[model samples]
Target: MDATLFSLYFSALVAVYLLPGPDMALVVATGASRGVRMALVTSLGIALSRGMHVFMSGLGLAALMAAHPVLLDVVRWGGAAYLLFLAWQVLRADMRVDTTQGAEGSAASGFTRGLLTNLLNPKALMFCGLFLPQFVAPERGPVLLQFVWLGAILVAVGFAFDAIYAVLAARLSRRVRSASPFRKWLLPTVFVLLAGRLVAS
Candidate 1:
């Protein structure tokens, strides 16, 4: 890969990743409700999902999904349903346990939430198909290697930004711990809003 092309792609990737999106919202919301550890774990799941997207894109699955609107809708609906489940989890959490636990839900559940949130978003998959190709060079050695490298870059950038958001939201939550209702209601609200957005789209 040309150094200049990689640099340009990195710049664009940073801008794209910095924008507020589902992944960022998930990290921040999880952090605020659950604590930094859970939020970080969630980021791990999200990073891994980025790897899945890269793998899917390399296999031409993303393009295939883009070509077929029904397939994309299936994924989208599944994602929206998953988000609703998450909201239900938040709303139905044991208030006393949640207060004592400080959002330390199961790490596995957090991971699953992170994974599904990304995997379900057809836009992310489609974006992978559209975005990566712009920086790839067919004649610049093995195409698959370039795809993996670019995908890794995207994941790394996303993880870093999401982690920062998680930490910041967690810190803010700590300061506002006195705001009991906010602590109780925030995650469910965010999840519902996200689910609505997914459904609307």
Candidate 2:
């Protein structure tokens, strides 16, 4: 097993999770108004959707790399470019928390929303395709297995961290309402750093 590769994947995953995104914000907002049960259900749906993405990416990447090995560089460069683009968007974005859309809904509805929200985002598929391939080494065993392992780690980590965010948002709804400007810039900075890391790696 490639411990070093796994470490890099883990670090990247953590950085990405830390950045403010629509999905995270939605989970937090849901938790704040709807409570833990819905938040968890929503998170489960999100996690499942991510798992589907990773599985599809694994299959597609493994096949493509097997046929066109040089495409590895393409995935790497593409991922880096995408990360840079995201960083630019974040940097230029207005960081305002919208807390007005957290109506209490059924667990099934929350799950469906979360699933559709993730599956509908083409960026998520692009992200998995780009990011997962970076850690795969042809010298290792089946590339598909490697992808599954790495993607599983990513999903597990993201779920845990997002769950914590849900609980915090729920417990501190009032404080979250009056959130400081620190988060606004902090997440953008993190995105910039992540983009740099993607390039440097």
Candidate 3:
């Protein structure tokens, strides 16, 4: 593995993960309703998903996808469409009591959603595709292994640190449950903003 690339990827992941974004919001939402366990599970899902993205990008899948102009267009549009759909769902979140046992259904879906979101994310593919090549050297132990290690670490660290964010968000969700006036406006607006971000990107 390339030590330098690993270090670079680690640092970049830390900076980017800490930024407020869809991933963070998802952590907050899951943690708020399902407790820390659920939040962690969701985080794991997201982490694994990111790993998949790195794998695909590093293994030439991303380039191959990009090679076919029609396929690239499909993926791009598909990702955008999914993001917009998620944005609407987030925006329309019910401020009323989360009376349902979300835990019953949230586990797999949370993980899957996290995974699929990253898999479909064009930004991730593009970033890794472009950035990874810069640090990769022929002397590296194994280029593929190096990429995997870098990507895996990035996701794992993200998972571990996100717990803190999830705890805070869950607490906030609890506190705000009774304040529909705040939730109705805040949550939906954030979703709309996230949607806009997806489109803009």
On TM-score, the candidate that comes out on top is 1
Query: Tens-digit lDDT track for model 3 on 110-192?
Result: 67656766666676776677766766666867787778666767677878777888778778777776754554455445435
Model 3 scores a C-alpha lDDT of 0.68
lDDT of 2 by residue, 1-201 (tens): 667766777888999999987568757766765566777887988899889889977767445654674564565556556545545754574443224534443566668756755654445666898888878888888887888888889889989987998888767754666654444554445435544554454
Candidate 1, 68-158: lDDT as tens digits: 8899899889989988888897788742334444444577778888988888888888889989988888898889999999999999999
**Would you list the clashing residue pairs of candidate 2?**
none
* Model 1 misplaced regions, further than 4 Å: 95-105
Error of 2 at 192 (Å): 25
- Cα lDDT of model 1 overall? 0.85
For lDDT, the strongest prediction is: 1
lDDT of 2: 0.68
lDDT of each: 0.85, 0.68, 0.68
Question: Runs in model 2 with CA error above 4 Å?
Answer: 61-105, 174-201
RMSD of each: 2.3, 8.8, 3.5
